[model samples]
Target: MPIFTVAIPFYNDQNYLSKAITSCLHQEFQESFEILLINDGSSDASLKIAKNFRNCFPEKIRLINLKENKGVGFVRQRAVEAAKGDYIVWADADDVQCPQRLKTIRRFFKENPDVDICLHDCYFIDKEGRPIDKQLKWPKSFEENPLYFEIKRNYFFIGFSAQRAGLNIPFRSRCRDFPEDYDFILRALFKNKKLKLIPEKLSHYRIHGKNRSNRHSYTYRATKEILEGLNLSELSKMLQNSSCLKEKEISLAICELLMTKENFKEALEKLKNGNHNCFYSNFMQGVCYFFLGNNKDSALYFDRAYSLDSTEPSVQNNLGVLKYKMGEVESAVELLKNALQNKPDYLDAQRNLKVASNGRNSLSITKKPLRLSWVY
Candidate 1:
């Protein structure tokens, strides 16, 4: 049996599936590894491409073609079930892997036997395979508890990481969106947190018009579904063991979900139940009150959020806009200027500052720009 099984699942993406499979087939690792390509009922030429690679390397490559259009999670689960290796790696059809990726992961696992999962870095590429974003590095805290960071940002791409086999084959979660990857990793880490990281950029994550993660509303609903599925007891335990300020973060997540649903009262109630000192919780509360048309209470919560984290440019811009709405032009201009100092390219702050300086009616503070949290 191969030492690693690289699981590649493809849907209708015939254009990039060949590139993904070729990368796996050309791995320079001295040790053996198998490529398992699962075709999820693609209406396009995806299956034909998989079979073409399988024909060339019959021993090293295998194919599993599903009859119906099952989702990505289900396809991945099928791939894992059919894998014969001791370790499993992930590969999206649209992403490319570095040639030494398998070799590097093999060496790391051999050197660090205690770690059950390994994650490496990857850079974002455009549709034409040109680098568009810098290499994404996992924060130090994420290195400590990868699951927590996964909740915040799903940076651990299937193309850059591998996990030991014989754990949960089909990772279960309520999330069915593109970030179902996050839910899968969370389940993998729940029982074993012994995750290690390699400091190399080992994959290229392709970003295109079809990237599902760009759909903010859909992604947020999926994430909230997964978080809500976690019982409070388990979630609280996770917070206690993993982080000091995690409760506040958890509360903020819940509040954001409520706010998205326009449950302003419930969002405020949830935020009040945890660390009120958190900049996120306070800011979310301000948002909820602002939406509910309680401008007085909204101003109070915005001030609280500013006091907690005055350095956050988004908060400063938000409060500045609110102050402008309240007829405090001088204070609004000063706050907007401070925000610009913190982040010079903040277009909203610059625009608001310009309006305040010109003594023109400010844009309806109610029409706030998209939340900064969603952009990342």
Candidate 2:
């Protein structure tokens, strides 16, 4: 059996399929690796491109063709089930894996037999494959249940491994829509499996207009469904009982999950029950109140949160919104400016700043509610 199965699944990715396949063929590792090209029922030239690659490298490449456009989850499930390697390394059709990715992963897994999952850092590149200013850096270790962190922000990448791909096969059905990768990480961590982070940048994640993550509304809905389906309270209880996480961390994670479902009151209640009195707790309480239209209490908690961590951009942005609502436009503007000064790319802060600077008249033109940053 091969040491690695590089699984590449595509649907209408005609423009980039060949580049992805070529990168796999150029792996620096000497050990045998197979490339599984899954054609997810694309009507474009993507199938033809895959055929050309398979024809050229008949011994190392296997093609799986589907007749209809099954979603990413279905195709991923198929890939995992059909993988014949000791480790399944995922590679998106639009992304490029580094030449050393396979070599590094193979060495690490062989040396650390206990790790069940492994992920590496990646550079965020534009559609033209030029490295963008942004990059992803995952924590080398976890202070709490890794599931909590995964829920807050997805540090997991497509170019990672599920040892033998066996752990992910059972989660096939839930992997529908945009949350397949997310669902897999959460489920694996929920099962208390060990996940390690290789600090090296092993891949390039392409950002384009057609990227799946750019679909904000659909992504939010799918994410909400997964979060709501999880027994967060149970997960929280497990960490609390084990003393694996502080009460504050557990409460914050629970509150964030509750807030995602718009259960602000429930989140506040959960926060109240815990011994959480930190910046995050205060910030979350402010967020819950802001959503519930209790600006008075919202300001109170935000003020407390600000006092604890004055530099926190979310606190600055949220507090600024509260200031604007209370007719303190100058103070609001200054707070928003501070937020922007700290995080120049803060979209919510930028939007709020525009409205705050222009006064109430712009509100009619925008017709959108003032954006507030949530504490996760």
Indicate which candidate wins on lDDT: 2
Q: lDDT per residue, candidate 1, 1-376, as tens digits?
A: 8999999988899889888898887888988899998988899989988899999999999999998877777877787789999999988899999899899888899999888888887778898899884546456576766666665556656666788887763654343354667677766666665777888878888988887767765776676666555544564566567654556666665555456556788878877776577667777878888888887888898899789888788778888878888898788888889988988977778887888888887543422223344113
lDDT of 2 at 69: 81
Candidate 2 scores a C-alpha RMSD against the true structure in Å of 4.3
Task: Return the TM-score for candidate 1, rounded to 2 decimals.
Answer: 0.77
Query: What lDDT tens digits, residue by residue, belong to model 2 across residues 1-376?
Result: 8988899999999888888888888889999899999999999999999999999999999999998988888898888888998888889998888899899998888888888888777777888888788755444345335676677766565555545556643544453466687777787777777787677888887888997876766876787877777887677776676546666776677778888878889988988888588877787788888778798998998899889989877788888888888888889889989988988976778888887777752321111122332211
Give residue 41's error in model 1 in angstroms: 1.5
Worst 10 residues of 2 by lDDT: 361-370
Clashing pairs in 1: none
lDDT of 1: 0.76
Off by over 4 Å in 2: 123-125, 131-135, 168-177, 241-244, 273-275, 333-345, 350-376
